[model samples]
Target: MPRFEELDVWKKAARLSADLYKSMAELKDFGFRDQITRAGLSIPSNIAEGYERATDKEIANFLNYAKGSAGELRTQIYIGMDIGYIEHETGKCWLIQAEEISKMLHGLIKSVRSRTS
Candidate 1:
């Protein structure tokens, strides 16, 4: 198995999570900030957990979780933008990154599944 830290998708997801945390540091809306940050954090965390699993099936399952979290994060970003919590440009960039991360997770899951079959 490969190290999750070495994966580009993991790196990007981690960065995005960090960026979200930093960007939201000043926001007074604790509920919104907490939910968004938690969703952002889950993406990379799930990827790492998946990569650490012993079986290909487990890994693929975790990757699916990560992909789902990416979608969750993107949804929160959209809501944030709509509510004026997130700056339009910053939210737009995050949306793109989340989508790309989801794609990367999908590719990784396919690769793992191929190895199984």
Candidate 2:
């Protein structure tokens, strides 16, 4: 398998995390900002961590974690948009990107699991 760094899913996830941090850099709410950013960061981190593992099952577990984190980040984006921290257009884009990342992770998880099964 290619390294996680070479995976488009990982690259997109890392980009999403960076964009989220940039957009939230000036938010007045520390709690919300930190929580969302952490969730955003977790997606790519989990992907890389999973790829470093020795077994397919372990890799799949980490990919699942990344996918879950993507869902969490999408929820936060919705809340942020509703609360006026995020503009509707930006939030919409982020939602779409997050969904794409989640789907990508799901595919990776299934592929890895199949190797084990």
Candidate 3:
């Protein structure tokens, strides 16, 4: 396996985290902002952490963590939109991106699991 930075899913996750920080920069609610940003950051963070682990099984576990974070972030995006913290279109885009990332994570996990099995 190549470096985590070399992975497409990791790159996309990093971009999403950066975009989330930029988009939420102006929001006054610290709790929500922190929660969402942490969730966003978790996606790539977990991927990198997993890649650094000793075995494919460990990596797959971390990939699952990343996928869970993606789902958590998606839920927060919806709540943010409903509460007017995010615009409808912007929320939709973020949701779509999160979903895509989750799918990618799932694929990666499956690939790793197959090899380990």
Candidate 4:
């Protein structure tokens, strides 16, 4: 398998994390900003961590965590939109990206499981 950084999903997740940071950089609420950014960061971090692990099972497990973090980030994006912390179009774009990342993680997890089984 290619390195985690070479994976399309990982690349997208890393981009999303950077975008999130940039988008929220001016927000005044520290708690909300920190949580959202951390959740966004977790997606790529988990993917890299899993790929470096010893087995496909471990990789799949970490993918699951990445998926969970994607969901968390999506929810926070919605909250940010509702509270006017994020613009409507920006939130929509992030939400779409998060959903896509979750789907990618699901596919990767399935592939890993089949190979490990």
Residue by residue across 51-86, what tens digits does model 1's lDDT show?
A: 888999999999999999999999999999999999
Root-mean-square deviation of every model: 0.6, 0.5, 0.5, 0.5
CA lDDT, candidate 1, residue 106: 90
Q: What is the per-residue lDDT of model 4 for residues 1-117, given as tens digits with 9 covering 90 to 100?
A: 889989999999999999999988998999999999999999999999999999999999999999999999999999999999999999999999999999999999999999977
Superposition error at 62 for model 4 (Å): 0.5
For model 1, the superposed segments whose C-alpha errors exceed 4 Å read none
TM-score of each: 0.98, 0.99, 0.98, 0.99
lDDT of each: 0.95, 0.96, 0.97, 0.96
Clashing pairs in 1: none
User: Candidate 2 residues 87-112, lDDT tens each?
Assistant: 99999999999999999998988888
RMSD of 3: 0.5
Mind sharing the TM-score for model 2?
Answer: 0.99
